[model samples]
Target: MSKPDKTSRHGERRRFSPSMLRRGMNLYPPFLGMGLRVKEFSDDWTVCRVELKLTRFNRNQQGTAFGGSIGAMSDAFHALLLMHQLGTDYHVWDKAAEIEYVSPGIGTVYGRFEVSPEMAEAIRAEAAGGDKVLPWFETELTRADGTVVARVRRQLYVRKKKSVTERERADFTG
Candidate 1:
């Protein structure tokens, strides 16, 4: 198959495959307005960054990046990480999410979402049985000054199709 098109024109590593729904958030006014960047991604995890620009400033607040921006980043992070673990066969979608704002934003905010070993095992077990809601996790968005601005917990429902024994090695898509 051909390589998926890169998601950004500015040379950010924050690219996504065609199957990634979070990529569609680029069209969202709230997310796009925050200038979120997918700086890096691999099979294990994803790192996303965002800057609080004047456009993101509501009421001219300099310290807090838009709450929506932090939430959106959290959503994208968990969704993408789950996708990596579940692959394309099992449709994974966000079931629920929560964010806690702990402190004011200082500078560029970065978030990282990682698929845990236990979660992977749990997901595999879930698919082994049948389609089911795998698991959910929490991630923190922090500023350059080391202040955690928000904690986001994301829940996802994963629907399994063919069992691993039934599908080819390469049939798995994510």
Candidate 2:
């Protein structure tokens, strides 16, 4: 896997391509411990698919997937997706997140996070004037046979970084 690109003009944290992100995430200690695998990432970074296999280390007392594992599997992807979509000019963070357990995940469970072009456009428009935008995204975790196991809702805060000129103007105006 290619190293994360460090080409930002301002020398801030470098932006990672999908492949790099996938590889990095797969090696993350928490994810690795929880049996969470980043299965796929779209070239444009709009979609990220993750899987959690039922392993003895991750199973609950009931011999099913643990709830915490379920929630962990759904975390981070939405924020990562938006961060990549918005590029280096913006800051993206996970404002809030929630998960509802609908059914017990028996075997392998998968979660997919996708951001549409319209959603990206809307976020860009909202943040163009230097205002923060809070957008919501939802994803479902399902078993291989299409049994719904959980639904996750994530709220993200996105804001465009003000240029030096814009900051100066704001300071002057204020």
Instruction: Identify the candidate with maximal TM-score.
Output: 2
Off by over 4 Å in 2: 1-14, 166-174
For every candidate in turn, the CA RMSD to the true structure comes to 8.4, 4.0
TM-score for candidate 1 = 0.66
- The CA lDDT at 77 in model 1 is 61
| lDDT by candidate, in order shown | 0.62, 0.86
Q: CA lDDT of 48 in candidate 1?
A: 37
Evaluated at residue 14, the lDDT of candidate 2 is: 50
In candidate 1, the residue pairs with backbone N, CA or C atoms under 3 Å apart (3 or more residues apart, or in different chains) clash, namely: 14-38, 88-173
